[model samples]
Target: MELKQIIQNRRSVFPDQYNSKPISKQVIMELLEAANWAPTHKRTEPWRFKVLEGETKINLGVFLAEKFKETADKFSEFKYNKIKRNSKNAGAIIAICMERDPEESIPEWEEVAATAMAVQNMWLTATDLGLGAYWSSPGLIASIGEFFTLKPNEKCLGFLFLGYYDGPNPERTPNPIEDKVEWL
Candidate 1:
């Protein structure tokens, strides 16, 4: 597919739409390679990925459900069950993290922006490969570092859920770009 179409057609495909088939490790590597190529100021390369597959994915589900239960003032069984079910069903879960520069030479927001760009690259590549992908930023995501044992400077941004799907790709109707852009 052409780059323009790929960008325009990219949609958040949910885990429920994914089929039961497993995604090849080689394909996942390609997606990571694409993410690696995203532009970063001063070559900081702050973005980091923790891939959870097979049994690890199951553990992630349990962790997320338990975290939600512990954090919520009034936990709903429905929400807890949904979170667990989705994590268990996903083909893979990638924990997106940003490793802050120890010296603090550059602003932290720049590092986050660079990480987001990296995720965008991965998303586009997933679209090209006909794989279902979605970036989820739940409130409990901030506490992921505790369970994942992330380094002191490393902070969890969110997670990218991935899988294979044969369902219809939903069409997106974005508002006019002109409204958001300003003349120089």
Candidate 2:
């Protein structure tokens, strides 16, 4: 697919829209390889991924539901169940993480931006392959240690839920890009 087509077609497809068809390991690896090529400043390839499938995926859902119940000021069963269900429905869940530069070679935000770019690469690749993918950042991400460990400098950014869906890509249109830009 052309870069413009892939970029424009990419949409955040949730687990509820996904079919039961599984994403092959080879395709997952291809997405990761694309992520590895994302631009990084000062050579700090900050993006790190922990892929969860099968029993691991189920465990993550259970863990998150329990954590949400234990932490929310006023817990809603609906939200709790949705979180759990989404995790279970995804073909695979990738924990998006970033390891900060220990020497502080670059601003922390740069590392975060680079990590996000990596996810964008994965998203575009998923779109090109006719797959669904979503990057979800929940308040509960702060407590992700309960599910996945992180090094001293590593932190969870969010989770990428990837899967295959039966539905066609929904039509979407964004406002003209010129609306937000001002040429000097």
Candidate 3:
């Protein structure tokens, strides 16, 4: 498919049929390569990713579940279990982290924006490959100092789950952009 068409068609899919089938490492590498091409401020590419699969994905699910159980005062057991279960449903999960460029002296927000662009690149690549993907940010992901272990000044942005579609993409009716544009 053309890149432009893929970009327009990519959708965040969460459905009931996702199984344990695994995506090959080569495809995952291609996704990262696409992300590596994203534009960044002052060429300070700040996106960091940890791809979790096999046993590691299970461990991550358990870790997130336990962290929520420990830290969320009002945590629902159902939600915790759902996260654990769904984490295993995807073929793989990519942990997205962002590190600010200390030498560049740019505003932190720019780095975050660049990181988002990186994720979009990855998502588009997945779409072109007919892979299912979604980006999710639980509250704990943003607070790297909390449940996740990170180097100084590093922050967890979110995780992207990728797999072959278990079912058809849901019908999407995007909100009309008539009220979302401006012309000077």
Per-model TM against the reference: 0.96, 0.97, 0.91
Backbone clash count for every predicted candidate, in the order shown: 0, 0, 0
lDDT of each residue in 1-184, candidate 2, tens digit only: 9999999999999998988998889999999999999999989999999999998998899888999999999999999999889998999999999999999899999999999999999999999999999999998899998777899999999999999998788779999999999999
TM-score for candidate 3, residues paired by index: 0.91
Candidate 1: C-alpha lDDT: 0.91
Instruction: Show pairs that collide, candidate 1.
Output: none
Count: clashes, candidate 3: 0
Report each candidate's C-alpha RMSD, comma-separated, in the order given: 1.0, 0.9, 1.9
Q: Residues 31-131, candidate 3, lDDT per residue (tens digit)?
A: 99999999998988999888888888877778788888878989898989987886788799898999879775788999999999999999998888878
lDDT of each: 0.91, 0.94, 0.83
Show where candidate 2 strays beyond 4 Å.
none
Candidate 3 stretches greater than 4 Å from native: 15-17, 142-149
lDDT of 1 at 110: 97
What lDDT tens digits, residue by residue, belong to model 1 across residues 50-150?
A: 99999998888889899999999999999999888878878998999999999888999999999999999999999999988989899998778767889
